[model samples]
Target: MASPDTRTQLLDAAERLFAERGYRGTSVRAITDLAGANLAAVAYHFGSKAELLAAVARRVIEPINAAQCAGLDRLLARTPDPPVAELVAAFVGPMYDEMRAGDEGGARTSRLIVTILSDPAEEVRSWTGPAEDAVRDRYLEAFTRALPDLPPQELWFRIRGILAVTAVDRVEVHNRLAGLPPVAGEAAKQWAITFLAAAMSAPPTGT
Candidate 1:
């Protein structure tokens, strides 16, 4: 049996490499080399590359999702009906912290998730869908409660918008705009939160 420390090392190495090269771009040998483990160790611990990728995702994603849910729960407990902005913050804040904390592994996992989600290939869904759904359902419920009057279709649109912005934000792509000042991390998050809150609250156009 692999020691706990060895398992952790393997996961750490896998997370960093997968983040850097992506799942398809990275290889089991590369991960094992970086981890200082052998091929046997990888098989013994995670079973396969696909499983390793899933493990890497779960290590980071599950915690962030839990934090998001906890934040929502705390807000709901304090007040029966929190404002749209607070709800948005609850959903976005933990993710922002992960992106801003300068954890390379977390950043890589975030990028990996965006890559998988953006891919139209159904196989990618097998790795990412369950983790995404676990947190998504909670936020959907919270948003539903926060904006009960919002039409279901419109609410789904706004929720998807929030997720799209989040994926883009995680990748941290820099697009140069002429004469536009840079927005720092906190500022960027605030902008997204404000935009999402407004989007969630906006009345249906056809109504």
Candidate 2:
């Protein structure tokens, strides 16, 4: 049987490799080899390679989502509701914070999520539903209360899509905007919130 720490070791290695290489690119054998565990350790700990990938993705995604949800708590306490833009920032700022806080592995993993979100087989895609749903619930509640005029379904979908773009874009945006670095915690928080508020509140593109 694998020890407690062995599970962590396997997860750590899997997170890095899966992030550095897409799901199809990472192998259970490689993960066990990197983790210095026996081949059976992977199977023993996590039923299959797909489960290992899900575990790795969860490690990176859960904390960021947790932080965002915590930030939502603060946003909720404000009297008369803050603008939707502020809410958007709350959604994304935590992710950028983690990515910059020596969570390069997380930054890479976020990109992998973008890939998964863009296209994935049913099994892989099903893994994301609950995690994303939890985070989305926080925003759905917030927006539903604050922006009564905005269509609940459309607003949430748009908010989610934009948040994904913001999270994934930070790494690349840095590469393109040589002089302008990505926003920091509070700044990103405000910026994302503001962007969401405007986008959510804006009329349709054709209009």
Best by TM-score: 1
What is the lDDT, from 0 to 100, of the residue 28 in candidate 2?
82
TM-scores, all candidates, are: 0.82, 0.76
The lDDT for every candidate, in the order shown, is 0.74, 0.70
**Candidate 1 on 1-207: residue-level lDDT in tens?**
456577888888887776667778888888888888887888988887778777877766776787887898899899888888898898987776665544542455567667666656555446654656877887788778878888888888888888888776656554343355544667777888888888878866666
Q: Pick the candidate with the highest lDDT.
A: 1
Candidate 2 structure, TM-score to reference: 0.76
Off-target runs (Cα >4 Å) in candidate 1 are 1-4, 99-106, 120-123, 127-134, 170-184
Worst 10 residues of 2 by lDDT: 100-109
Candidate 2 residue spans exceeding 4 A from truth: 1-4, 129-131, 152-154, 170-197, 204-207
Q: For candidate 2, write residues 42-94 as lDDT tens digits.
A: 88889888788777777667778888888887887875476667777777677
Candidate 1: lDDT over CA atoms? 0.74
